[model samples]
Target: MSYCGHPGLMPIEQALNAILTEVQPVTKIIEVALIHCLGKVVAQDIVSFVDVPPADNSAMDGYCLAIADLEKTVDGVLPVSQRIPAGAVPEPLTSGTAARIFTGAEIPEGADVVVMQENCSEHDGKVLLPPVLALRDNIRDQGQDILKGSVVVSKGQRLRPQELGLLASVGVGSVPVYKPLKVALLSTGDELIEPGEPARPSTIFNSNRYTLRGLLQALHFEIVDLGVVADTFEATEKALIKASNADCIISSGGVSVGEEDHVKVAIEKLGRLNLWKLAIKPGKPFAFGDVKGTPFLALPGNPVAAFATFLLLCRPYLLTKQGVGNITTPTFTLPANFSRKKAGMRQEYLRANAEVVDGKMMVNTYPNQSSGVLSSTCWGNGLVVAPIGQTIEHGQEVIFMSYSDLLY
Candidate 1:
């Protein structure tokens, strides 16, 4: 994956690699109950202390009998010596006799196989055995599912519902996980107004705040929202100082070269702007830097730009910082239902919908690809990555990234 665009602009892949290389995972680890471990990355490998199904057990509600005993029975009949239900221990199988065993019941010592109850009929004092039986049939061997001391879940793996169940299966009540990353969110623009406020001639409601907030929340990060800062160098500097207390800082707007864009200058005055600008459509003004010793990410003011840049760059960096091992968003190669006759210089991520048409999956891009059109994002389920200097034709194969893959 190489991208060709403006000489000074960084490629999206290079930008992501740089950000990941610079960020380090937090060292703090806390023990959390299994019920609360969802979306939390494990601090260490989770090893099983015991094997699942600690003992050989019956896999069916049937009769347990030693093969030799079954062979010795006359007229395929054996006396029932004992009954074993799930969780009940059984004595050694009486010779020439069978034990009535329920599913999950531990196999009695010296029992060689179990026959499903459907195969035999119960009488007044004996069970009629099947004419033939296979050794160990309908029996679950001990340790078949999981072995003792094996790693059930590796370090840095995020826990989902199934993971919680796995930990519980191994008798783990609590898990050690890295502390959630704390991020200070700042929206810088005087023209920005909070939602629910009266509309003004020149002010627009700040959608970036809610957009970034929702993204952060989806990743399970702690957010310190500083709200919208007045578009001034002083206000930006003050916010940066206050934001330094967090593990990382993410600010939207005030990153471009415009005179009112004071975040770039403020960051440089406090720390340093390591990287600026990216060769990506709708998000060329993205910036990466440090503010008062804390890592900072500056996004373009456009709501769509901020949303795309965060998923492409900031999300991975934040996940790395949170100790997650696999932060890559999955992409699929699908045929396009639309076409682009001309290619732009920068790589473009078009908001697109992917659906199955006549048994084939195809990508349908929204007609409008404007950075300021936030509605386009909601209208599409994923993104179609249009490479720099490349024109997409109808039915051409292209990389499609689903929002379901990126949101988390």
Candidate 2:
């Protein structure tokens, strides 16, 4: 399973899918308040017993009157029978009369249609309707948007603000949803310092922790941070032990085979490390395995490498393991604005800025494409994915993928 002449490695996608297929979502459900259920996966389909807009109502502030009432009007004036504002029930409509109903007000017992106030003039105790008006106009029907005993949301659907509002309209106070995936995060490097600490000449501040943490939160994960682990075997083993307790463990910096790196050996000693040297630039070193059945994803030490690996492999895998379907990174074809020299054996993702100009989509890579540079990612909105060993030319079609499309 070696890749690029490296032992103990496999293709990235194959390794990810293998682990994901073996793991299943924690098949437990909890009733959570609808207010806090946004971005959570629904455990089961939610069927509503009550229909939305239970009764026919006006969709706007207008007059609710029978079609026959408009026929007898000699001029534009018709006598107003009653005024029904929103949330109030009106008495049955008397013959030859109209009721003033506000938006969302239930239709009266005998009214069939609602006429907008703008269609004609409204004077003292009188409403005017055009002669060409049709029946049942401007009225919201019962069960129009959602029906009773129908599943409004399917299982494994992520709850959003609009979904919550829809469920509330059907009188659902709470919903059954899966718990957030608990991810253990840590950084392993003796030369790395915390953000607030002063860095020595050869030392750099730890960036992976914050980067991964932010991305994990965006994916609705509950993070358990193990902080920084020194490169020593003892400290690294202890950190791995802490990470093994979580549902999944993610560590950066020690997965590579550099002499100073020791995460791979520690992972093997503690549990397992299925190394995957993917044919992808900036994210070749990937590790996946389990410790006592808890999954572990060991990413590379380079900042861009870690980000790319997480987005391409870990993000979709985690989502699928948590009961999410349609787990794939979205990509689109856009014209390349710059030509670059590339000897392709591996797929390369160049940081690029995309814009639709003159009804055509275009992607232009930034000048700096360093693996360790954080500014390259910040300055670009998406990635230009060039296939394995494929050199791209200016104005040529290229596949572009956005970070937002991958995580959220």
Best by lDDT: 1
Q: How many clashing pairs per prediction, in order?
A: 0, 2
Question: In model 2, which residue pairs have backbone atoms overlapping below 3 Å?
Answer: 1-9, 344-389
Off by over 4 Å in 1: 1-5
Kindly give the stretch of ten consecutive residues in candidate 1 with the minimal lDDT sum. Answer: 1-10
Question: Whole-model Cα lDDT per candidate?
Answer: 0.93, 0.83
Query: Candidate 2's residue-wise lDDT over 1-408, tens digit each?
Result: 456444544555576767777677766678999999888889899999988889888998988888877887788577899999988978999888889889999999889888887886778878778786678889999999889999998898888789999999998899998888899999988888889887789998889999999999988889999888988988888888878888888888787768778778887887776654666778877788876668888888899999988888888878877777567677888889889777566667888899877787788998987788878898979898877656788899989998779768
Model 2 has an lDDT value of: 0.83
lDDT (0-100) at residue 67 of candidate 1? 90
On residues 1-408, what C-alpha lDDT tens digit does candidate 1 reach at each position? 234737788888898888888997899999998888889999999999998889999999999999988887669999999999999989999998999999999999999899999998999979998878999999999999899999999999999889999999989999999999999999999899999999999999999999999999988889999999998899999999999999999999988999999999999999999778889988999889898779999999999999999999999999999999988789999999999999889999999999998899899999889999999999989999999889999999999999999997
The estimated TM-scores of all candidates read: 0.94, 0.95
Number of the top TM-score candidate: 2
